[model samples]
Target: MSDWEPKIVSFLCNWCSYGAADLAGVGRMQYPSNIRVIRIPCTGRMDPKFALTALREGADAVWVSG
Candidate 1:
């Protein structure tokens, strides 16, 4: 079988969580490479439809950080 990596869709708040993610990148933190981040102005502005769409589009998981 072919190697498979989980596809994760992450919704991050522009204020804090996004910055944390940036730090993780700058620090060279080890994490699955399958995660894809989407920055939003705020968690309050997040819509359920976005997660649904990500799932429908074949994302193995969806995460939100704020």
Candidate 2:
């Protein structure tokens, strides 16, 4: 059987969370490829419709980073 990777959408703040994610990549941290990153100015900038759209688009998980 083929291994299935779970899909995860991560919304990170441009100031800190995005930096952390970049560090994770630069540090060669091990993680599933299914995770997708979206950088935003801030967590409060997120609109409910965006999350709804993500869910409608078939994302297995949505992560909001502050």
Candidate 3:
């Protein structure tokens, strides 16, 4: 069997969490390549349906940051 990596969907707030992500990138931090990032205007605007959809679509994990 082929090795499988977990697929992660990350929802980050534009003002804060997005900057952390950017810094991680700029600092050349190592992270698994399977994570997919989605930038949102704010955590207050997050919809539960988005996480549900990500799970339904076969993402192994989901992360929400503000």
Candidate 4:
């Protein structure tokens, strides 16, 4: 079989997690290609539905960070 990579869905806060991700890009640091980022205004305002939806949509894992 070919290489199997996990699909990760990440919900990121616009002011925090998103910024960090951008900074990583600026620094030329590498993350796995499997990550999918969704930028939201704030983690406090994030709804449970999003994580559930990602899981249902076949994401191997979900990450939420502010």
Candidate 5:
């Protein structure tokens, strides 16, 4: 539908996972542009509802990193 990029939502832990992703970027790690990452204080804090809401809102994929 209209040159849409795949909507990928990633929930990452603030201390570890988020830092890793940032490192990946800084290292020039090429990845799909479809990803949209959201950093949380911790992966333990994520609720099921948050993932459901992402899909409900039209995300093609949702990933959680810890």
Candidate 6:
């Protein structure tokens, strides 16, 4: 149980959240391995079906960042 971690599906904007995540990597910042990133052009491009698909595919949570 202690070893369990939430599996998250994150949809991030290419020039925003994704860039921050890339910068975090360069800065050696730590983020949870549970977060699975899917880069998108913009949050506006994100579809509701995407989140639903992620959930149906077994993700514990979904995050959208612009």
lDDT winner: 6
Give lDDT for model 4: 0.93
Measured by TM-score, how close is model 5 to the native structure?
A: 0.87
lDDT of each: 0.92, 0.87, 0.93, 0.93, 0.93, 0.96
lDDT by residue (tens digit), candidate 3, 1-66: 379888999999999999998999999999879889999999987899999999999999899999
TM for candidate 4 is 0.91
Candidate 1 structure quality by residue, lDDT tens digits, 4-58:
8889999999998999989998999997788899999999978999999999999
Error of 5 at 33 (Å): 1.1
The weakest ten consecutive residues by lDDT in model 4 span: 1-10
In candidate 6, position 55 carries an lDDT of 99
TM-score of each: 0.88, 0.83, 0.88, 0.91, 0.87, 0.94
Error of 6 at 23 (Å): 0.4
Question: Pick by TM-score: which candidate is best?
Answer: 6
Clashing pairs in 1: none
Clashing residue pairs, backbone N/CA/C < 3 A, model 2 = none
Q: Candidate 2 versus the native: TM-score?
A: 0.83
Q: What's the number of clashes in each of the models?
A: 0, 0, 0, 0, 0, 0
Show where candidate 3 strays beyond 4 Å.
none
Q: Name the 10 consecutive residues with the lowest summed lDDT in model 6.
A: 29-38
| TM-score of candidate 3 on Cα atoms, chains taken together | 0.88
lDDT of 2 at 4: 68
lDDT for 5 (candidate 6): 92
Kindly report which residue pairs in candidate 3 clash with one another: none
lDDT at position 57, candidate 1: 97
Give the per-residue lDDT of model 6 (tens digit) for 1-66.
Answer: 998899999999999999999999999998779999999999999999999999999999999999
